[model samples]
Target: MLRRSAVILVATLAAVAGAVSPASAGGPRHVRGTETIPVYDYGTAIRETVWVESPLDSDGDGARDRIAADIVRPREARTRVPVVMEASPYYACCGRGNESELKEYAADGTVSLMPLYYDNYFVPRGYAFVGVDLSGTARSTGCEDVGGPAEVASAKAVIDWLNGRGTAFDASGARVTASWTTGKVGMIGKSWDGSVANGVAATGVRGLETIVPIGAISSWYDYQRYNGILRTREYVRYLHSYVNGRPAEACADELAAMRAASGETTGDFTAHWAERDYRTAARNVRASVFIAHGVNDKNVSTGQFGLWWDALAKHGVERKLWLFQAGHEDPFDVRRAEWVRTLHRWFDHELHGLRNGIDREPRATLETAPGVWTDERDWPARGVRDRSLPLGDGTLGAGAKGRGVTKTFTDESLREDALVANPTAVVPGRVAFLSAPLTAPLRISGEPSVTLRIQVDKPTAALSARLVDYGTGTRVDHFRSEGVVNLATESCWGAATATDDACYLDTTEVTATADHAVLTRGWADAAHYRSLRFTTPLEPGRWYDVTVPLNTYDVTVPAGHVLGLVIGQSDPQFTVTNDQNATVTLDAGRSTLTLPATGAAVTAPTTPQSITTTTLPGAAERRATDNTPVVPLR
Candidate 1:
């Protein structure tokens, strides 16, 4: 860790020193060390206090209640400075706290706007920072609905208030003069605060410039409920932390609400919990955004990045995505310099009208492995050729042209299926596929979908599929959604169940549950399997496959990479009904996994003709090569 830290520090310093242009240095002085700058020294700074009533009458009680904030203005202020608005529930109990804990603003001649929960971090940066306590949290009035619309409205109201105050800083020695209203504000925060940034962006409020939403949830339903499987472990742990760390009554109420909502868990994207989901809100954000997520983030899945990227792309809004190699609770300073540099360039270009060339940088910048950063033109870059391999006898091979090979399993040898549910225990009669070694650097940039054809003697059964990367010895367990289908039930398309024998069923739409219902009485529980397919982009490499316990299936790979397909019957992690006497078959050629393809070059297009290219935060010096995964463009 020490060696790694040193390398990161060195790389950051080199990047900053090399990236900043001589022309972009005039806006604000970059602080390299701590100095007693008057704008940030609370002792010397002029301080003014004020309160605003909640614009939202929460209880429908027409009367508004008060929210608090502390405004600091530098004694000598000139122009309308850029505003930094911080939204958080974490507040200082008393004024006398650690200097680091305070929201420090620009101490060296920048406007410092400090909101209530904001510490002194805003002041030292010369930014007119406003720290707001959304709705009812902290010293503010109204109930804290967390990231609900009401809280979002409250944030907007605060922005509006700041706008009305103009460039003038309060009595405190901070910059609050009307000369600082650039109307372009940047919102920054993490976790719940990050969610607030997302919510405010969704409101489509004007003058809201750029946003940096880090470690935030994009979909509440998919993340919190575990596809409606009632993730008791995660829920319990979270509630415990909330209850212990937060005020007792508030935590208790939240816990109670979660408990009551347990049975309502359904992984369906359209469910009630998804209403407040950030993915839904990301659709409306018009501002330039920089989204960062920890690859190993457990509380919130890395899948959120993909979801948001897709949404933003669909809306034709460009964004920058960075996936760090950190965990949920890790400190932001791990990548602090890069983050600050990125923000500086971004805000300078947008807020200060500086041509910092941030726009010329790749649309997607990812820290693929530990310390290496790679640039790509777009997310899931095209030209990621697809290659499919076949699954058979624990090995992966190129599938016969237009034909699928098959294997069979009987009752006595169904141990392979059981192993997936219990990794320690291997079940017999399980089929596995191992791919060939990768010949080149390849990334399965998108989700893989599968289709299967089989016959089960039993009237009902369930199927599950997963994609694994054997090279890194790490399972790409991340998925947008994992689905299971019940064979006993009639096929349904757009809400219609097919009761006929000849049915072309697409299992993607079918949602399953633990509850059982009788489908048919059977002498032999038999349902013919037509085909099995799993679709995903594969780079140039070989992969491995494992079967979900208890179900019978097949594996087929596309053209560029090797594929491993595992067929099984039951997955303990998922609820599956295992009945007696199941027979499965793979229809040759007819079964296929269709992977989405983008045929264009994977690299970014040549710098746009009209846009002049400028150097970025680290363009000059060539850094040492390290073993880091190439960052993909998004």
Candidate 2:
């Protein structure tokens, strides 16, 4: 496993070291106004397949891997077109886009059908679309390691080949140069495809002009774990096995190696996780990044986007963000027309070197309501300030209430809705705190955190915290994985052919009118409260501090709504709990909950959870912790 990880790291370093500046071939071109227009025929677009050599031999077959690139370009484009690329493991397996489009080959061995709308819409707009199969998936070679180094290098190799830094061979075993392209590239996709774009751009690879990562993961560890809490076991093996369509016997060792190295049980921040985390590589990003994510996405949490966004900002990278209310979805489905036009202008400005003013626009777009969007200067609402309200017996306020009160609960797994129902009641496994109704609308713009001084009768427990909004309103039904339901009708964006089309089934938002909604929540292991990278055993009855971070979000609670916080044990929906059966006690006087808000103050009464009628069900909650400054948990 160590040798395999080393191979990946070494291959990545070599690929980046050999990179050079992008160049143009200088051929016929056409344009209208400030943007490139659809001046070429889509049906007559050139389709071909090429295999670019990879640097990693992940299969240990004594040969380096080969990556398959499927291209669709306008026949009219001799050399003037830039490229839009998508590297993925799903082309042959899970498929791509909302309709699950797959590739079909012609008798001449060229691609007769290219999957997504990129080939249809952008090829006619003077942009070539290159869909590269991830190594070990589809027609590509080597073992697929999920978001590991081999997969990353394979995608970057495509960018290198486009810029004349690497070599490729066409269908006839003939060497082919990318003289047909200007070497300006923009990578875009959703889910794992988007994650590949992120990894490639993080390499500081030359010729990668920009990237659009929608509903993508920034860290593989965060994908399966939350702060030290493992959400699922053996996902490394499951995902790699799922994506690799090759015979199982071929990559068995590769899969086993990944599972062993992933720290699937301990849930610690091990070397395997550090290697897949992109935040540490944010400084290497040279391309402009336009990121899109759903605040409610469960497949890939918002923390992946939030932490990555923060790291990029600190490095002074050119970036923009779009946060929606849907779960694990694409913004195109939410606002199709605006998204297409906005994406078109973004590519034009970044890849074509046009002055489209996209970079000068506001840096953030957030969906404040079910269908309403707002442009903001930055995320977490620009002027967000950290406001800490001390936890009381039943109230949260500046004035201390519950000075000597101690609250106890047994560490047991329970559904969040059941624990939060009628928040004022004395639930067996959870505690609740609520603030008074707000006088003005409050917009929570950044990550919310909680601190608790707790004592457990056992060595460890799973600590969960939730932030909720208490009021009736129309909200995105995040529990529904499909943010939008597809309809029978279709809408076209570009020209179509017999095998492929530029149109897709129309979709509408799926929403629910509810009295409350869980905005964000987080979970952590009590033993790992001190360090997400390491664990410290408790003395059983001694007090220890723990900090749990809720996923990042941007939402406005109306003036009439009340803010509530619920502290509980294991949340069955998202976590695999220790089931320690330990009795946990929280010191109310020393605990604090900090939030970022635009307008409005927070106040609450004492003893809401201890009393039934006084508490509000489906209440707001953040997190809890002890006295020590827990480093790197968030």
Candidate 3:
């Protein structure tokens, strides 16, 4: 697709076909390729540091903010090549990659080491690798706004400087320009790093060609707030406090502003949240997106990617998606070889101008199950449709035929582990319904919703639902570090030097045996069921129609396993927003559970059992769990 002479195209094709030209040949400027022969010595690679100026004065110093950027490039290149950049706050605080490696500086104020494998692998292959310390993190001059305008603009300013539209200064306070490289750029990162890439891409910067956001957040509001419920209060302030390089008091006012504007107490969507949401600006994106996410991610949540993908589709943006069976993890850790291979082809096709057929391939690659991957033309599996199942006395019926019986349960400060135990037995704080053991496999490819016609005894009550797959099976134990463990042995990916190496310790999946797995969950405030922007206080003892949407999922329930629906007060795993302990009564005939289902039609549910006081083996823990849930380390 590139406009070039036949000789140049054939040379590039030869490089793409694995017969990379010798190092003597001009690296990328003469022949476009990122996976080409090593044309530069990494030991002698040029390392430079710069501060890019932004439009805002986020740190209140009466001067424009400047973002710190570290660059590593091939010293042999005489002509312009492309760039692969990562803008992150983790370079100094949380570090990056499996080992949490932080940036190491040389005594001369130059970069002694670039963290992660990007510089070691790509710099010698012709791409300049730039690592930027986001605003308020590391050496950058600004306050961390969690994905607000200041953080986003700080990243965009670096890209602007690359495109000759912004100002940048060297360590010696002399102005510097990116005259040695082409303006085309690609951004890549994980978690908060990826979240920043999403924000910058949403700005439609002129020089940005593509982005690879791994386990990133698309909306900060959705990150800590699910539906109308607050997952954790003041999460933004906590994140800011962690990333800021200044003293606690130096950034105290900024953190205070974040908490005051976040509406954590009311759990409402306000203009403050809108400023951090990238989906609203998806239409402005000119760069292509390649998203990688853990289907069971709880830190950022899986809903972030689903809604962002939908919005990208709405705007006809070119994109590709990879859904894995982990939580808050990087594909590089889950699928290393494939990750490197595809990313090579992707960067080549987008940045290096290689005429690869990646664009013509399937748009989605999903790990349908453990070690099972499939490529599909579209997501939601193409034939997926919403299936409505009625809530029976103690069963999930296939049709709208349910006895006119009412069920009651009281609100309790129970965690997800306690609320889902012994689903068939009697429990005071939660009510559950079960479907027949499946004769065939049933898969759900998207979000699920639960509707209840209930009357609460208090002014406000917490509404929570869990979709569980009930069967003894092997599944990713996300509670144990996002389904991976770093081993002692290591594998090399690219070139190495005396100080920096491309080799990293390998990782493998973490799985465990389980009787029941919670596929997805949802929660909402009964008072905010009407709208997320404002609260409509409920009248005690009055029936209200409330619907809560569970987090997105793509999972299959095997034969001989039953689908279970557990309705409870809240999952203290995220947070217990309400502590009213009020009683709730619901009409079974009017309540229903809707799933994004495909495969097998259910005609009836297995008969019900009488409610008893019997509980699981750990009766005390099943009734009221005292063990705390693991918080994500991101």
Candidate 4:
């Protein structure tokens, strides 16, 4: 054994040696006060705040509106970097993510706990993260115009300021210029926040290179009504109150004006809704987009995403997609690690001009189940053939010989479950039809359409069609009519701070083992069959050919399963069942259901197979009745 003094000296010398040693042999180093420090530290990010000027007097105030922005950047960014922005109204009202984090301000009005994990994850990666408060929200000065010009302009102005074309101010009210930026910008958000991104991109503003809008609304009209049928009567008033969160009297005038101009009584696509339609201005989009949406989202409707995606494709805009089966959810919660990595590469390729192979990769990523994901070269996978299945004599088949055979149903007193149950059983107020058990797996990858030739006693009636799978298996219970249950367990994603933490406990994604699963559904009014912008009521007892377009979906029906189409005159979930009960007759010879089929060629059976009469237990209730706005955090 060595002496105590010798042992102490040896330990002291080893501690000093370890303290001065570099973490890695060839790591990047920075000289600080005669010492060498490793330069790649991810925890040292700079957080600050500023206000960009907007040329909008939406509040009817004399002064122009100013948008408050919270910024975070890498501490060692010696040169200018590109920007990633999220402009939203929820930072003040509903907060963000499953935990609902609000913005925390310092004594001097500087932002502290910025909402989502964008700043916490991206700032350390040599990118600047910006959280912008929309005009009239939080510390910004103006009236929130929802999707109007004022809201769109407020976001565009921030991009302009970064590119040296607009103005911003510091905390002391002094004008400041974004001299530390490369003028490249990318915006990402969900719900209303994503709507702002879409609206701003539709303006073709300079410096807005890309956007990632998750579960966003492209048309405001579709949110409140469906094809001339009023659904949510007080959508505007409800949304205004939900976003503002201030004293109702403060914005009483604005709210009243919004309700008056909404055209709710007529349920028409008036000029007010026209201004809020991003599809009309899609030709002006110059930014590449990455779109993500839940196919089962009743709040923002999958139709909005389908229409916007189609419009962007027609305009030849570069785009990508992430379609899922959840309802009103963010992709981050569903696929966190992959989402973060994919998003990082997308921003780098679009904003930093990095030659990442993201653009060359598959254009679509679809989630089939809770932990199942698949990639495709493009959405609505190529080589889809439309198969027309006829509806006649209580059977859905490929051929219909019974011309005079007719099924009648009234426009009152029927639930969706009762309509889709036991097709062979006699059900009043609705008609149900089902195909024979599929010989092989059938995959549907696009929208399904319904063509009905009918004569009705009333001038107008609500039409609903549901595509269902009748078999015993486990699948995603998409129609969670009674919302999701949040468990006590918690999960952490990205970095966490005292004021704002990127932690969330996953909510439930309803699953069930039953006789059938509602694949997709569609609704329309008979009077608006020809045109949604205009309506012409039908003459009583006159034959009319009406086609209703159903929601888009991608699902694979297992072998031995039967495809079903349930047609009903009214669905109490959406439109109130027409009070005046009217008898409707269907012409079997002309009625057919068109499905976009994928995989092996399937010929519909000429002879109708025996219909299965199994009743699925626990029928899902209807969602979308409530007007409470859900701000999705992506």
On lDDT, the leading prediction is: 3
What lDDT tens digits, residue by residue, belong to model 3 across residues 551-573? 88998789878788999886666
Cα lDDT listed for each candidate: 0.42, 0.79, 0.80, 0.74
> Candidate 1: which stretches are off by over 4 Å?
1-52, 59-75, 90-125, 165-180, 233-271, 281-283, 329-331, 385-432, 449-466, 472-634
User: Which of the numbered candidates is closest to the native, going by highest TM-score?
Assistant: 3
RMSD of 4: 7.3
Clashes found in each candidate (C-alpha, N, C closer than 3 A): 108, 22, 0, 0
Question: TM-score per candidate, in order?
Answer: 0.59, 0.91, 0.92, 0.88
lDDT of 4 by residue, 1-634 (tens): 1112433433432342223334334332322232222232334566677788898876765778888888876677676878999999888887876667788876767566777777755664557889988877777877776788878999999999999999999989899888888989999998888889999999999999999998897887777677766665577777666677345565677778888887776566777788989999999999998999887786677877888998999999999999877777787766766786688779878986766688999999998765579999998877777888787676676654547878788765466666777766777877877676788888897778899998888877778888988887866555553224466764443443445444556566666677776778787778877777777778887999888888777788888888888888766665543424767888877899998887533434466465554545444345344333333332
lDDT of 1 by residue, 1-634 (tens): 0112333433433443343222223334422222111133222334444455556654344556345454443333444555666666553322111111323235442224232222233343344555666665555555455345556776776666666632222334354333445666778776556667777877667778778777665555444433323323334334233313235464456446544543333222332354457667666787777777655443454555567667777887657766654434212333444555566566556666666577887876655543456778866654644443333334433433334455555443232223222211234534434345434444545434445444444443334344432221211111111111223322110100011011112222112221111110001111212211112221222221212211111111223333334444433332222333444444423333333333321121122211111212111211211111111100
Q: Residues 1-634, candidate 2, lDDT per residue (tens digit)?
A: 0112333433432342222222223423545545666657767888989999888888889988889999998997755689999998988887777777788788987887777677767787789999999999999889898899999999999999999998899878798888889999999989888888889888999999999999888898888777787776666777787789678987999888888887777888888888888889999999988999989876677888888888998999999888888877888777887788888889989887878788889988888888898898877686789889888875665664868988999966667667666776667888877887777988888788888889998878889998888777888776654467787875665555666665677787778777777788888888888787887878787999898888887888999787788898877667765545778999988888889877887877433333233232322321121111111100
TM-score of 1: 0.59
What TM-score does candidate 3 reach?
0.92
Q: Which stretches of model 3 miss by more than 4 angstroms?
A: 1-20, 23-35, 609-634
- Score candidate 3 by lDDT: 0.80
